[model samples]
Target: LEVRQCLNHMTDIFDLIDAGVSPGRFDLAREKLKKKFGEDAAILRMLEGDARWIELWIAVANTVKHPKKTERIVVNDLRLLPDRRIQLPTWQLFHSTRCLDAPQALLESADIVIQNLLGLFENLFVVVIDQVLPALPSGLQWVLDDIPEAERDPKCPQRYLLSIGMRNARHA
Candidate 1:
């Protein structure tokens, strides 16, 4: 459930990026983005390359959001195999639409999804700096500062400070 929420939140971010309709709808946001940016856009190409995994995640998230009796994530389930081997307690997600030969471990899957999203965000940040930032109108422009390695958060090394004009530059 939490994983689904996180993915949905990402869609919200996408909607914000579009600055258009579809507040929390991933499908609409994705389509609008492609239409606005064109298929050849770097951001769109990046998403296109990761389409498979993204679809799998969407399926998993959807399964949790609208759960059916047989198609539900199994949390910390332990199983005994036919050969009497013990399977450790593990989070698993299974749905027929996105069938896995074996159940996918949820923790690892969630970690992968998050890491991929973060990587995509990092790439998008570069696009913003190179393409979007320069196009901003005058006073609306923000000053961007890259945090020093030693001062940056370990988990989020790409952290930067953005302030509007010199008045707030002292904070950075």
Candidate 2:
């Protein structure tokens, strides 16, 4: 598709998502989108690549796992969409995970966290679908599903970002 068409398509999808549609329905819509725009991951990674969703995912996960260490890690500095400082959590997470100073490495670690979270999300949905969906009031599912996190898809957009652009760009 042309750039304009791509933009238009993305615009429409965001519009639906902003309308608070169910994730199942949104996931279905994305499938339909992929049929035309190639695989979902390609487009998803493009939109998601380098987005603030990474830091947010890291923030939420770190917060939940280590609430007592909240003061040590603050996610307030990353107003940028594609936050490069994903390693902030490792330092603040209260775990002995090796420091990830390289921004690209930090981004990849963030993706790992996101992938783990997605597993949690799918499992949570499976359990909730039968028990809660039937019992909850109308329109509650879509509004509560939380797509703010959906912006991150278990993979970094720029996992191989040239954090240290080479002195030997092409020495071979």
Give candidates' CA RMSD values in order.
Answer: 5.4, 20.1
- Model 2 TM-score on a 0 to 1 scale: 0.23
Best by lDDT: 1
- Residue-level lDDT tens digits of model 2 in 1-172: 1222222233343332232223223344445445544564444444344234333444444555565542233333333346653333222233233223323334555566556444433433333333333333432332223334545455632211112223435321
Error of 2 at 8 (Å): 32
Clashes of 2: 4
Q: What value of lDDT does candidate 2 attain over all alpha carbons?
A: 0.37
Off by over 4 Å in 2: 1-104, 133-172
